[model samples]
Structure formats: structure tokens, C-alpha cells
Target: MQATNTLPLDMVYHWEATKADSLYLTQPVGNDQVVEYTWGRAVDEARRMASYLKSLNLPEKSRIGLISKNCAHWIMTDWTIWMAGHISVPLYPTLNAETVNYILNHAECDVLFVGKLDDWEMMKPGVPDSVRCISFPLSPPNDFETWDDIIARCSPLEENVQREPEELATIVYTSGSTGKPKGVMLTFLNMAYAAEGGMEVLKVGSDERMLSYLPLAHVFERTFVELASLYAGFHLFFAESLDTFVEDMQRAQPTLFLSVPRLWVKFQQGVLQKLPQKKLDTLLKIPVVNKLIKKKILKGLGLDKVKLAGSGSAPLAGDVLDWYRNLGLELLEGYGMSENFAYSHINKPGRSRTGYVGENMPGVETKISPEGEILIKSPATMLGYYKDEEKTKETFTEDGFLKTGDVGEIDEAGRLRITGRMKEIFKTSKGKYIAPAPIENQLMANQSIEQVCVSGANQTQPFALVQLAEGVRDKVADEAYRKELETTFSQLVDRVNKTVDPHEQLAFIVVMSDEWTIENNFLTPTLKLKRNVVEDTYEGKINDWYAQRKKVIWQ
Candidate 1:
């Protein structure tokens, strides 16, 4: 596989030189409204933005913040920042004012770019007076300069701005589930290495279509939609909103799809709602009916055209993977972190294990440390944490391997199965240690469960606090619904307990009626459960749950 040597700006020039008239981005603003950009147009617009950014006369390598949902302007701004010799700082659109303030101050962003957002009033207080504000389409409330106005006012930059591989590209803040977010400094070389390695494994072509809905603030989406698209020259499509996700997917008919485990589980539940699990199972056992059923299922979900589907950011349940595989979509699981540009381990097309995140990618090395932590050495490894030299030094080993903080064992075939996070494993009062991730994975297999956290800080045994699925919560007070839930949860707990050690058996399963959402601070922007938050919220209620006689308790 050939490695990428040129910087992203050069890649843009390459695409423009080769495929000038080809469609590059499609952004939907309304039901029937879409703005399309060819590779040539996108380059011209980015150059115009770059010209304007240069006219500001900001210091070289100045940190520029971008706050927006996924859109063409977001990518264009990123390219513009890089081309103008500045570092990009992307903030999550759903972030609160305090966090936004923290990130902006921490990164010392000189210029802030605002795009399509939900609440500008809530975020306005965070924007410091020192930083210059620039607005993209669907302008935010303020005295910021608009994107169209800037492009119209400035001429296209004619002089090519050259960048080295080791030059700083972006500062991506980790979406920390437990503590304050830290900035991960990534270079052009790091991103390019990741894109080259991933493209080698996936072999995506220019014709490949991808839906860009995930937060580009995260490395996962940024790597695929922004970085890899530049390398692979694939067409990118943006989702209008959550309400039109299905319609967007159908219109894009993406050849490659990547999503988190939570969405994959929701897809499973969506299918089960139409075809009950029992009936679907029975039908799958039949000869020709199974084929037709699989087609209908995938077509309904707009995934029938997907050649490669992947789940990451969180561990996916084996049952959910099997469910999709049965429908003829190999839902491969990959593993990586922000520090590595998410270019570590990925399951290959025809060679994937059920419960493991597959082997290391090209030019990557992985091993389990003596302390059972997964360590990685790769070209894509980040330079360091942005502002904290202490934390950065602490994250890597003396021998240069990045300590992943995940406890895992490598199989004989080199596949890695994550056991638990080192900080997340809790010990019972009886001196028994429990790994919650495996249990949580098993519990999530139950159709009624949406999210769960297992903890027993000083108790004799661990118990689970579960958030019921959305559909189940709709009929909460109905006697029939409650009875059905209790029965199913009881069975699930019993089955899980039987599979684990006696000391690790759950004492009770407490189901919560409320939903866990990013807006509520229960989940990260990437849809990963905030276990620390969940445990803290339900810690006081656990004793009462355990005191109840029933094995399943509803809160």
C-alpha cells in the first residue's frame, strides 16, 4: 500500500488538477434544498476563505476555533485554516457555555468560526472579546463576519501555501466521559498516515459515497469524512438534521457507513419493531424467505447499498454484530483513540472475529503491557497533549508506546478484545474485583435495555442501573408493559449471572424511566455513556433498589 506524503492542502490541489469538475460535497439545508459543490468550486471557496484569513494578519500557526454541526462550510473552514498556515480547533456543537469557554481559553484561539448551531444565546457568553468571530451559513447571533460576505469581499489566494508533514494540523479535544476534556495535538503527518493506512485496508474509491453526520470534532468522523475523503477523493454528503436522517441516507445511498455502537443497537431495535425477533428468527430459518427478508430489512434501513459498515467509539455487542451479519452486512468493529488519530486496529473485509477489534493496521504495532494495558506504536501517534506536558508524558511509556488505559489481551491471531478500563474496574467490599464492560455488553443484548452502568463501590456485589429503550419507556405505567419488562429483565439478569462468577453476580437490575441523552449530560457527543455520571446519579438509589425483594427494580 502506498503511503501519503503530501499535506491535505496539496491533496486538494491534486484533486482539483485531476478531477476538477467532479462533485465533491452535497449539503442539504431544507426539505428540497441542497447546495452542491464540485471539487473545483470547493477548492476555489476554500482559497477565498484562506485569502480572507490571511488578510487578518494573524500570527502564523494561530489557533482558529470552529464550532458547527457537520456541513460543507465546516470542512471548507478547516481547509481554509490549514491553507492559511493556522491550526484548527474544532468544538462540539452540543457543548455547554462553560465548556466552550474552557476550550476557547485553553486553546487560545485567535479566531472563532461559527456555523449552523442550535443555541447561540447559550454559547454567546463564552465567546471572549479578544477572539475575532467569523460566521458560516445559518449565521449565529452576534457581530461576527458572515462567510458569504468574506468570500465575496476577498480575492482567491493565488500563491500556494506549502506545509510540511510534521506541521501542526489540528487540536482535537477529547470528549472525556469522566473529567475535563484535554486537547490532543495532531500533525499533518499523523492524519495522513492514518488516512493512508485506513485506505489501504478499506480500499475505498473516488466513487464511494459517505454520509457525514457524526461530529467532525471527534477524530473518528474527522479521519474518515475529512482526512480520508481528501486522500480517497470520495464524494461526501451531509445530513440535514436528525429528523431527516433516513431520507438523507436514502438519497446518499452511501457505499461506506460508520457509526457508533449505540446507533447500531437502535437500528437493531428499529428492525425488531417491525419484525418481532421471534418471527424474524423463524423466517430466517426458512430457505428462500431468509434471502428476501434480509433484502427487505437492509433496504428499509437504507443500508442495502453499503459495501462496508463499521462500528466504533464504543464496544458493540456480539449479538448485534451477529444480527447484522445474518442480514448480510458485515458490521466490522474497529478500535482506536484520539491520541492516535483513530488509526490502530480494524477488522479486515473477509477476516473478522466476532468479539474482537481486529489486528493492527499497516505501519502499526500493538502489544499488551505487563500491567495488561493495551499499548500502541504507530506513525499516527499524536505529538502530545496540547497544553499539559505532564499529562502527555504520563500517557506514553519509557519505550515510546502510548498507554491506551484499556485492559485487554491479544489473541494468538493478534486480535484485541477489550476487557475493561483500568479506572472503571471496581472492587467489592468482599475484596472481589468486577469488570463491568463485559457485563454491560451482555446486558445491552437485552432488547429492553438502552444503556447501563454496573457498579458496587463498597457493596458485597455489583448491581446494574439500566435505562430502558425508548419504545419501552413510552408505555411505562401500563400493567402489561410493566409485567413484560419485569419478566424480560429478570430472565436477562439470571442468564447473565449464570455466565459470570458468583462474586460478580448482580444483586439487582434497576431500570430508569428517563432517557440518557447528550443534552442531558448522560452521554458524550459521540453517544458513549458517561458511566461516572450514571453511577453518581443513581448511587443514592442503589441501596433502596437492593432492599427490595424483587430481582428487578424500576425507578
Candidate 2:
């Protein structure tokens, strides 16, 4: 293991110079080859940006925000924000205008950094005039000051801008399922402790390689990208674009892979793309082809070289875990919230519980309250919600453990298995409580269904709002074919309903024409369905789906 040198920002260059010199990000620069940056250059850029930030003279702990997608600028901007004395706030780039304005006002931020995004111009109307905006990569509307312009106007590096371990560093706003967004305040010590703990757990070292594809605005990516990669020297490769993600994954062939459950399912779907179910099943009947198929899939996902592959943000299915295990991938599920720096319980390498979210992470203590809420306390937990003392005070018990909102059980082996969100579970007319998650997880295992939201409020039986697999629309565009598919879907609902108890049966199944996405606000950034949106859209229609009671028919 290489020793880490303390700097204002995390550095791959100083600790692992050779690997850092390797091409890290591989994205396009217009029509030319991909614009690549070396770790040495990245560290220097962060320092220069930090120096520029010091020139601004913002008050200590003042809120600063960046609106952008997952890009090289995102990291540089984050480094600069932290390197400065001011606190950092990152917003969802895809947020609606109303939500964006609310967050901007809620944070009371006066200075905002803007970056390249899809339809950025459309959102300009909602930005508060009080906030001064600087464009990143400082592209056009030539009136605004560019990032480089700021750097050029700053004093030279002093070599004395230090970040104390306990200072408030970053504030991340979470789009919670039950309510509007709230800023979660975290200190340098909180992040560093999580990074430090993760390093030991993963046995990460200089030789380890990682691919950064998830949104860095989220806590999981911030810890993994900033802290872990710094302390343990790992080379990073960024995806070129949305169109080039799979090819880029092939090119990077990373050893340490981390993804949310949605991407994990997508990767599995990609594997199945080439090998259709009927054909793959027929080939598995033959001995040699089955072994070869497994090898092919394991290699395709870059998992052939993977030391660890994790599913987090949401629970993955046991059957899905079994399927991945067949291909020689170590699929471990982890559980944590944005409130705790996303590292409370992890399915560590070698010792894994496919059903459980794994044992508590090192130095973190987890206990289930009598009401089945998961309670955790550690240095890694956030200091509190930013400026919301009432909510923060309510987040903890009298003994000072943070309430996780998740309903879970700890087994004899001390592994945590989350059953459902306490609020999401609903009671049926028969008085039997239905846990939506397990049913939804099982429904998702079917490749045809993309997103499923289960609900049973004031209904005899629970139901699902299903988003279809990608390209399912174009494939079924024909009116006749669409009708046929609707018929087949009803059959599918009947099959699924037969497998469960009477009260738990899916009485309603609606196929969404448009996909549920983070941008659409139907899904949170983490890709979990916003149950409220799904329920709101179908609340009146759910009864309609059941009133017809006609199988083998279109709506």
C-alpha cells in the first residue's frame, strides 16, 4: 500500500504517480479524440481553483452551490468548494424549475457555479437574481465570468490553505421519498472516517482500478471518488458519454465496481440482450455451452476482473444475486442512507449474506428498535440536517442514535435484512399488512418490467404500476401489437397474482407509456420510484384497472 500525503484535496498523483499518470477520464472533446486529464494535472487544477476561491473572501460556512451533471468539472468544482473556507452544496442537475428555486432559496446561497447540461437554458428563468453565477468550462453567453477567468484573477498559491479534519466541508441535499429535499450537513472528519474505514474493508491498494459512472453529487460517489481513491491509490476511468457507457466499461475493465441496483439490473439486461432467454436456456441444457456462456457474461460486464461488485441505494433480489453468482461475480448487497455517509452496513468481500444488507461496517453500531426501525450511531453519521434543528432533533432518539426510517430485522448472525420503509407499507381490507418491497423486488426480477410501485391504500388487494423494459415501446408501436402486448400483460399479472396470497395479489397493473426517470421526478436520483408520484398518477385509475376484470385485453 502506498502512503497518503495530506493535501487540501484527494490526490491520486502524489501517492500513486505511475497510475495517476495513466489516462483517467476518457470523454469526447467535440469531433476529436477523448479529452484526457492526468492525475498530476487534476491535483494542480484543484489547488489553483482552491487558490481562486480564497480570493473571493466569502464568509466562513457560507453556502455555495454547483449545478451540473457527472463530469470532470464536477470533481474540480467540489474540490474548489471544500478547499475554500465556504461550505459546499450540490444540486440535482435534472431538478424541475420549482424544486430548483426552492432549494436555492432554502440554502440561502448567493453564489452559484453553473456547468454544461441538457436544456440548461430552459432553467435559467427560475434561478434567483440574488445568486451570482459563474459558468464552468466557462462556455458562452460570453457575458458570464468563466472558471478560468476566476483562476487567472486570483493570488498565487500560498501553500498554507489548510482544511481542519472537523470543519463543516460539504452539504448534500437529499430528495427524500416522503417530503421535499433537506440539506444533510457533513464534516471532513465524517467523510474521511468513512473513506478510511472503506479502505480497510475493501483491501484497496495502488493496483486497484475503478470506473466512475454514478452521479458524484450523491454521498456514495463523493466518498468513493474523493476520499477512498485518495487514501488508497486507484486509477479512475470516466465514461465517455451516455451512448458510449458499455464500450467505455469494456475499455476500462475495472477491478473494483460499485453500482446501484438499477444499473446492476441494466448490466444483467445487457448480458441477456445477446442471449435471449429461450436460446440461453436451450444452450444451458448442453454442458460446455453453459460454462462458456457464464464466462462470456462475466467478461462482458468487466466482472471477470472484478474483486468486488456491490448493490446499494436499494435492495436487490435474492434470485438476481443467485444469477450473478452463477457467472462467478461476487454480488453483495449493502444498506445505508444519505444521512450516514452511505456506509453503515456493507456486505464485505468473502463473508457475504445475499439476503442481508450485511453486518455493520467497522466501528459502526446498529440496533433495531422495538418498532423495527434501524438505529445507527458513528463518527461517519452526518453532523445534522443543515439549518433544520427541529428535523435533526427528531432524527435521533433520546440516547442519540439516528432513526433510519427503514423497517428491518437483525438475524442471529447480526446481518440486517430490511423489510420495507415504515411509511410505505400499507394495510389491506382484510387487515393483513402488505410489505411492498419484497413483492416489488420479485416483480422486478422479471426482465419485462422496469419499475414497479406497489400500493394498497383502501383497496382489497395490493397493485403495481409498471414501467416497461427499454425499447419496448418501439417494438410494440403497432396498434395491433400494442393490443397483443396488453393482452399478454394481463396474463402476466394473473400469473404473478396467482403466486401470492389473495390480499397480496396485484389487482391493478398499468403499463406506463413514458419511462419513469429522475428528470421526470417519477424517480429519485438514486432511481427508486417516487411512490407518491406513482400513486398520485394512478390513484383514481387503479380502481378502473380492476373494474374491467377482463384478462387478455387492452385498456
Candidate 3:
């Protein structure tokens, strides 16, 4: 695999099957017809899109807002916007009405492209009256023109485009942790280098099948799915919906895979539900039953053919990864944040590390500061926050290295292991500090626990608030069943405490039930549990969980 500096120099990476032939995406967009296109045809569509943009008489770098789920049309429209020398602003599909308006307004968007949307009309309140909104629906409404109509009206035109490597490609607004969304400005060169770096690392063959289910609007997916696949000739496919993702994967049989920790846990939970943890533990004690159970679990998930699998966006327990390996799937975890265009580091092919994010991607320099926070310099790093000069300045050092908010250690093998978030660390009255995410992930690895929140604030001992799995509803409600849960939880807590530092051990275990969902504002679009919300919601409920002060709090 070549280094980032030596890989792709252009936005689109393609392959040749015949004369001028290349690979592209195939999918159904919300009951829309299944459609497929060759790379050559897609290029033609993009050029036509650019032609329409050239006729708009807009000034250079005029912002264009594009709100859509992942689709081939999304990429075609994105490339078209860049081809016309305009900036692209992509909105997340799962955003609420407030953020839809916020991103369009913040970007000062002059034109909007709406793609095969869900609940689109209800979301229209966010658009400014002055902004001309166009629809890219598979079947556009009578009032607005479909993308095909717009492309047909404009004559086919290609440009002698001139863009510096440092030119801004798109503005990606991250979900707000404090209040409102902040746009992160990413340059074409910054993104291109990162995609190339990932290609250099994974080295998967161009013929590999990739399922593009994650939101392409995200920097992580855009760099890996949109850009990396283009350069590698991988045939990309999209899911019909979340419920049908597994079906699509079986059809596509994707060789390369990526998912957040929570989704992977859901996959594991589904299997374990069929064969409860107690049954699994019992079977594992007997070698014959253990081998048979592992085989059954792997076959059920269709992971038998999964060439590569990995989880990121949150910490995953080492034990979970080991379990997958025992069943013959080598699940490696990687680490990166939005600022690095989401490709700063990844695990190497054969060399796997438990806590460390793999080595820095090619061309990215990394180091640990005196305080142990990770510092990085890469062409892939975001240029800065959009329209927020002060925040941008605060995010970098005097010499321009992006300050990764994580504390970490670098091992002799060059793998980077994250300890905790700098701001997330909480000090106890006993003068010991704790990072909650790792402890929480470990707790959730227990078969019954779905989500876990750990906080100490001003208290002497830290504790966990965990939600039981939905499938365990029967046991969750039964008092006799509840007793068994308490017993299991107490042992789980004791086992965890012996493994970690005395100060970091969880003192109380609270069994909770309300699911952490996007609809309820408890999870990010990427599915990470909202730490702030968890701490805030459970603050009053803490006493209810701690009232008994037993080893486990089961209500």
C-alpha cells in the first residue's frame, strides 16, 4: 500500500472492467426503484450537475446545502457541487427540525438540494424563505423539480476546473455537546490524504464489496466510504433501511465492515438472547458444548464470511473482542475523531492491540504531551471550525497541532492507547480521578446490561447506572426474576472491581430500564451514549438506586 502522499490525487477512484468502465453504488432509497450506474455514467451526471450550478450566476464558493441519507445521487450531487467550485454543506438524516434550520442558516446556504428524504415536508420549517429549496426525490413533488429534470434542462458541460490542494471541499457540522452545532471546515486535500491513508492501511482489493450504511455526511464515513472506495475500485452498496441492513449485507456479502461499539454489542446481544449468558457460561465450562455454541453463534450472524470487522467511536471491552476471535472472527478496533477527518489512526492488518488505537495513518504525526493528552499533525486534520475563529484557535497549539481531547500512552509497538477524555475526568473527595467510558464499556459487556453510566462528582465512591437488555423484559419485571438479576449483578460488580484500580472500581450498581435512544436525545447520531445527559437524568434517581446501599440496586 502506498502512503497518503502517493495514493489518489483526485476525488473519484475508479476501476476499468471494459473501455471507460468503473464501479459504483446500487441501492433502493425508501421504496424508490433500485438503480445502478457505472462510474463513467456517474461522471457524466456530475458534469451535468456542475453545468446547472454554473448557470446559477452565484459567486465563487457559494454555499449549497444538501440534506439526504446515503445514496449514489448524494455523491453525484456532492461531486457536482465541488466541480462547479461551490462549497457543499451536508445535513445528517437523523437531525431534528432545529438543527436542520441551524446548519442551513449557519452555512448561509444560498441553494438547497433535498434528496430521497424521510419526513422531509415536516422538516421544511427550518429553511429560510429566501433560500431556494430544490428536491432530489426519486419522484419529486409537482411544485419542485427532481434532480434528473434539473440535469436535463441544463446542457451537458464540463469545466476546466482549477482548485488548489488547500481549497475547502465541504463544511461538516458536528452534533453540539454544549448547545448548537458547529461547522468543521475540511479541505479537499485534507480529506483526500486521509482517504488515501486508510487505503494504504487496509489494503483491501478493489473488487471487495462494501456496504455504505453509515451516514456519508459524517467525516468518518465520507473519508472511508465515499473517498476510500472511489480510489480502490470497491463496489459500494447501500441498505434499504436499518431493519433490512442484515439482509442487504447477506446479499452484498461485504468483505470489509465497520460499526460503532453499540451496534456490535447489539449483534452480540441478539445471539446471546437466543442462548442466554447463564447457558453460555455453563456451556463454556464444558469444552464440547462451548465449541458447538460458538459455531452456532458465528453462523447465525452471517459473520462466517466477514473478512474484516472493527468497531470505533467508543471504547469496546477487550473481552468482547477476544470472544469474537475465539469463534474465528478477528475484530480489531480503531480510534479517530471528527477533527482528523476521522482517519488519524487504525489497527494494522495482523498486529492487534487491546487498548491502543492502531498506529497513526500514513503521513500523520502523533505524540503525547507532558499532561498525557494526545497531540497530532496531519494534512487530514480539519482546517478549523467554520465561522468560529475563537473556538478554532482554542482547538490548536501555537505550532498548529490539533489538540486531541484524549489522554493516552504510546507503547513500544507504536500503538496509541487512549486512557480518557481530558474534560471528562472527575475527581473524587478521596483525591483520585477516574475516566468513566472504559469502566462503562466493561460493565455493559455483561450479558444483561445494555448501557452503563458512571459518575462520582463530589462523592467518595463512583457507581454505575445500567439499563437491562430489552429482551430481558420478563425478568426485569418479575420480583423473583429481579432477585436473580441482583445476584448476577453483585457478582459482576465484584468481578470488575478486582480487575481495575481500587479508586476506579464501581461502588454501586444501579439497574435502570429507560432505553437511551436518538428520539430521546440520549445518543449521538453515531450512537455513543450522551455522557452529560446520562449524568443529568440520573442525578435525582441516584438516591433511588443507592437508597438500599446493597451491592446491587434492582428496582
Q: TM-score of every model?
A: 0.98, 0.91, 0.92
Q: Candidate 2's residue-wise lDDT over 1-555, tens digit each?
A: 122234335443354345546554444444335566666556556667777667667777678888876666677677677766677888876777777788888888867888756657666767899887888772336356787777666654546356776788888899676588988988877777788777877778867777777777788877766566667766666665677766767767888888988888787777677777677778877887888887787887667788788778888877678778777788888877789888798877677877789988777888889988889988888889988999999999898899998899988888899989888889987888888998888778777666777887878877777777774656677888777777777777777787788788887676677678887778887787789887886677666777876543232
RMSD (Cα, Å) of candidate 3?
Answer: 2.8
Off by over 4 Å in 1: 1-4
RMSD of each: 1.2, 3.2, 2.8
Model 2 poorest 10 in a row by lDDT: 1-10
Which candidate's lDDT is highest? 1
Q: Which candidate has the highest TM-score of all? A: 1
User: Which parts of model 2 have CA positions greater than 4 angstroms off?
Assistant: 1-27, 30-32, 138-142, 152-156, 284-287, 477-502, 551-555
lDDT assessment of candidate 3? 0.77
Error of 1 at 417 (Å): 0.8
TM-score of 2: 0.91
Per-residue CA lDDT of model 3 for 251-294, tens digit only, reads 66777777777777778888877877677778878977877777
Where in model 3 is the C-alpha error above 4 Å? 1-20, 29-33, 138-142, 160-162, 277-299
